[model samples]
Target: MYRFLFAIDKEISYSDLKTLLKKGSGIVVDVRSKDEVDKGRISGSIHIPVENVESDMSLDSAEFKSKFGVAKPSLDSSELIFHCQLGRRGAAATEKARSLGFKNSRNYAGGYKEWSEKEGK
Candidate 1:
């Protein structure tokens, strides 16, 4: 039942993600590595870096707990949209998010390259 409902291995359109972001709720995470983030990211994305996500600690563990100061749902386990260069990492992140119980996670296939182009940056 959960698998059917929260399947994370799904691709969402770039326009859909952009609309969600403009609507002003939920989280947008960048599952890319730190070096990738250093190259510039979507202005408001939380950089969890995919490596931390694969650890036994999970993205919701002590490290982020201290950062958020609350036992809230981790970005990986929350309603979110993820993106990375070309979208592969975003797809991986969606699967991880579903494994962690996020029913509304999705991968933005167009990624940062698309975003930068749209924004003329």
Candidate 2:
């Protein structure tokens, strides 16, 4: 039951994402499917597929806390960063998150592909 005042399509750079990871200021969510995630993912990112993001974000859902080792985000949570194998799904996931009251949601434009390639993972 929250309204967003910020742009829903906002995106974050790979560098900025890395910075956030270092400081641990945001919740990094991998919106890829389980199979894709099994292949690899950013260190410390929570695996919440785009299809199940909304449900998992619910405070009543224990999956979020059990999987991510943190409580579900409230309407005024700090930041929720979403990424996928590429940028497309991440962008869509960000939109979904915004619609669900996560106004701080952002998409990592350069997704796992760019991240792995750049980091040589």
Candidate 3:
């Protein structure tokens, strides 16, 4: 079941994400490429570039886990939060996830830039 404390919308805020992570109530997906990711990313978030969201999310649980180091989130999960350098790719990935049946997948619209500046990354 969706345990999010805030509105279950298409986007999530940094403050809400912090609470989500603290609660272990969701998964944060970084949809940026290797070069972008090498700069920085949210701790504990899984990396699956925007170009690969469909193929990777389509993998079975075991394969997905082996590939991404995290369990494949069920299609019904509302906690698959996507993010990118400045939100564009994250929004795209979120749409891709939604198209794949992740009904309530959300994007972290603030992206890494906002996050890094806030966290001093």
Query: How much does each candidate deviate from the true structure in C-alpha RMSD?
Result: 4.3, 4.2, 4.2
Residue pairs in candidate 3 whose N, alpha carbon or C atoms collide under 3 angstroms:
none
Which is better, 2 or 3, measured by TM-score? 3
Cα lDDT computed for each candidate against the true fold: 0.69, 0.84, 0.91
Judge candidate 2 at residue 104 and give its lDDT: 73
| Alpha-carbon deviation at 64 in model 3, angstroms | 0.6
Give per-residue CA lDDT, model 1, range 1-121, as digits (tens): 3554544446667677677678776567788788878988887677776655545225455655576443445545534677888888888877786777665677888988898888787
Best by lDDT: 3
lDDT (0-100) at residue 29 of candidate 2?
A: 91
Order the candidates by lDDT, highest first: 3, 2, 1
Question: In terms of lDDT, which candidate is stronger, 1 or 3?
Answer: 3
lDDT (tens digit, per residue) of candidate 2 on 17-78: 88988997778899999999999999988888898877777646486677679777766665
Which residue pairs overlap in candidate 2's backbone? Answer: none
Q: What TM-score, computed on C-alpha atoms, does each candidate reach? A: 0.73, 0.84, 0.91
Clashes of each: 0, 0, 0
Name the regions of candidate 1 deviating beyond 4 angstroms: 1-9, 54-78
